[model samples]
Structure formats: C-alpha cells, structure tokens
Target: MIAKAYLWYGVYIILNVLTIAGSDPSGGAGIQADLKTFSALGVYGATAITALTAQNTQGVTALYPVADYIVAAQLDAVFRDLRIDAVKIGMLANVENVLAVSSVIERYKPAHVVLDTVICSSNGYLLLEPCALAALRDRLLPLASIITPNLHEASVLLGEPVAADEVQMIYQGDALRALGAQAVLIKGGHLLGNCSPDWLIEKSGHTRISSVRLKVIGTHGTGCTLSAAIAALRPQNRDWTNAVNNAKIYINQALLQSTRLSVGLGTGPLHHFHAWW
Candidate 1:
C-alpha cells in the first residue's frame, strides 16, 4: 500500500511511485498531469522525463526528445533510492527511450506498472514516433500490468478503425490482451452519448467502468489524468477493479467540475483539484 507504511522511513514500504513520461509545460498533460494525480491521491511521486514539449491548451508546437542515456540515468537514479510501489508511463518520444525504459523496468520490476499507450495528441501532433510503435508493442506490452489506450489508440495498435460499439471494443480489447498485456483498458470516451464506458479486460473476464459523459467544451488531459489516477490509486486499493473504479470516480468529478478552471483557449484541462477548491 502507498504511504501506509514503508519498511524504512522515506524509502521502501513508503508510497513512492515514479512516472516516466514527457514534460508538458502546458500543465495539462504529460508529467505535469501525472504528478498532480499522484499528489491529489496522496502518493509520493518521482519522475524520469522522456521529452520536453511546447504545448498549450490548444495543441503541441515543438518537441525535443531527451537523450536515451539521460532517460536511463533518471530511471536508475530514482530506482536506486526509492522503493517504487508503482510506475505510470506516458509518452515515450522515440524508439531508443522505449528500449531504455523497458530494459530498466524489466530489471527493477516494480509491483504495479500502468502503461498509458499514447500515440498521438488530440490536436494531431504525433507524440510517439511511428517507428517506435513496434518497440512499444514488442517490449513494453508484455511488461505492463495494465495498458490504457483510448479507442483510437486501440485501433492504431490493432491496425483497425476506432471501435464503433461495445462489441467491437470488447473484441479489440481481447485482441490487445492476447498480444501480451496482462490487462487492457479500452477507453470508450469516443463512443459518445451520456455513458462514457471503458472496458477492463483481464484473462479471467472483463468488466465495464463508466462515468457520466458531461457536455464539456474542453478536455485536454483526460487520458493522461485517468491513467495517472490509476497508477496513483492502484497501490492503495486491494484489487485492480477497485483501483480503476476509484480512478474513474476521481476523473469523472474532475471533468464535471472542469468549468471552474479557466486555463486555455481550445480544450481546458480537467479540474484536478476539484475536491479541494
């Protein structure tokens, strides 16, 4: 459990989790969103930044991928000290970083690994290179405890179109699971209507996790926020179902209260601090 108690003070047994992702100066997504989720959920958060992006509430302008050695060094530095309870991986900008991260993760073997299968930005900026897609599928999928992919991302992974309905979503999820992910969360937010459903498919069975889809004008960081919430809440919950449910509850409330935030022009970020203000 996170922050419940550690074998040592400020060390193993404590609630220390690392987020290996890119840096979003927009403060709506990437490492910024992940850290907010961790802090809001009362978990200790660390970082191993993969890239730096110039993005706002509107879209991405430029991206600079961090060196592979630096990425590995950051992971090593964090893992060498903290007793990481879980790891939330978001945008890996290239193939080299993917291999580097997977190699280190394969060695340390954190208890919980939540992989956010980020492919492209909502505004059409390619976050992960097309060349890196194979590395992600071959190396990262097998290691992730649960992989979170939106409908479009699922389609990209399977080389098919976006899942149109629940039946298709389930089929796609099962296929992705068969590819090696222990569990697959196919986010159905793109399906439209009042109920925004996400399917949690495991080897034993699958279950639906849905939230009221609010008629919001802007939602730039839903994927980053949701997946980060899962990583933050996983160690605290007894099972994966409870963890995902709690995360859903959090992101739903954040979306419902997003109007309170006047952040950007096109799509505003979720109200990550909804419970407080």
Candidate 2:
C-alpha cells in the first residue's frame, strides 16, 4: 500500500502543461505541435481544442471552430482536475472562442501563459476571424505572461505594414508590449537575411536572440513549438528571457535535425523528438 501510494504521488508530481488551440489532423501544427513540444520538453500535456483544421504540410484547406461553451468546458475540466504548470494558447478562430478563453484565463490565472497569436496559417488561410482581433488584443493579450507574434501578426496587431528590418521589429515589439503583454517576442522568420532574429521586449528592456538561418524546408509549426516550449520551460526557470532563449536553441536544433524528414510535398514540420532520437 505504501509503494502504491508513492507511485501515485510521483504521477501527480509530474509537470502538466495545458495547450488551448486548434487541432491539425496532419499532426504538424496547432494542438498537435504544442503537445509534441510539451512532451519533448519533459512536461505532460493536456489540451482544450478551440478549432479543427484539415491541414497538412501543404496548407490549411478547411477550419471548423468548436463552440464557445465546449471550449470553456474543456478548460474547466482541465483546470479543475490537473494542476497545470503552464499554458500555451494558439489559433482561436472567433470572438466567442477568444472571449471564452479569456474568461478562463482570468479565473484560473495559470502560472505561465504563452499566447501565440496565430492570425493566419502559413498557406494564407485566416485562422482567427477578423472580428476576433479586437477581443484578442483587448481581453487576451493582457492576461498572457508573454505574447509571441510573427512579423505579420505583429503588423496586424499594430495596424501597420510589416516591420522593414530588425530595427523596425524592435520598435514593433515595444509597441506590442505596450498593448498589455508582460513581454513580447517578435519572431523574425519572415525577415530576409542570413540570421533569424527574435526580439524580446519587456518593461525593463529588450533582447535580440539571433540564430543562423537554417536552409531547410520543413519548418512548419515553428512558432507553435517555440511558444509551447517557452511555456514549459518558464515554470522551471522562472525567467522569461532565459525561457525564450532556451526555446530558441531547442527550435534551432529541431530545424537542423528535421531537414531529412520528407513529411509532405510542401513545407514540413520540425522534428519535435530530435533531442530524444
């Protein structure tokens, strides 16, 4: 009986991360990628799916958003049972879903929240509805511990064109931080250069984490993976900057290792289990 009790205690002590996002049937992005990332980083993953996508390496063909009440119920179920250590949010499809998630965040107040502003898919399919942008910016951004936005999403939030260069990215990062996120990570994957730079903006200052751009094609789900990694790492490190840096390093490695994986004809996904293999 004592041995069984210890075993249960050990199971209960494992770190748990909740990913609230859309579902990707291809297992390359959305909740799929987030779950892979959490597992790769040694954190147990739970999920509250907000949408479902018929997507693959090529592109997103269709999206079906889950009902708001169902989304809320999923979150409630997770929080009430599991002691969630961190949360990573992605791909909220509409205003109702956004508001539903926002209300749950306000209630649970999870230790770490990484919001990956997935406005659109890489293949130019709109993931978040146009009307939901206002609710996301107003209600969700403030509750997040960090907001990770790619250059294009940052532009959408800022109501401007894409940042011209690294300087403009920094400026945009600051502007995004002002919108209420405790920190902003402006990803530079779209930037044309030999290096990919991510600008981290906080109230204290900003940091530029630059890595040599890997010449690889299978780079899908990089943003989702990065944010999920940060969420998983933040609770252990307790420093947003370090968490971001570590996540970047992990992503770089994943990109490098995933080059040979020919999953699809178009853009492919990062090798989430690169470290393990």
The collision pairs in model 2 are none
Which portions of model 1 miss their true places by more than 4 Å?
1-14
Model 1 TM-score (2 dp): 0.95
Where does candidate 1 have its weakest 10-residue lDDT segment?
1-10
Which regions of candidate 2 deviate over 4 angstroms?
1-12
lDDT of 1 at 33: 90
Question: 1-277, model 1: which lDDT tens digit per residue?
Answer: 1225435655655477799999989899999998988887778899999999999998999999999999999999999998798999999999999999999999999999999999989989999999999999989989999999999999998999889999999999999999999899999988968889999999989999888778986588889988888988888788788899988888878888889999978799988888878
**TM per candidate:** 0.95, 0.95
Window of ten residues with lowest summed lDDT in model 2:
1-10
User: Model 2 compared with the native: what TM-score?
Assistant: 0.95
lDDT value for model 1? 0.90
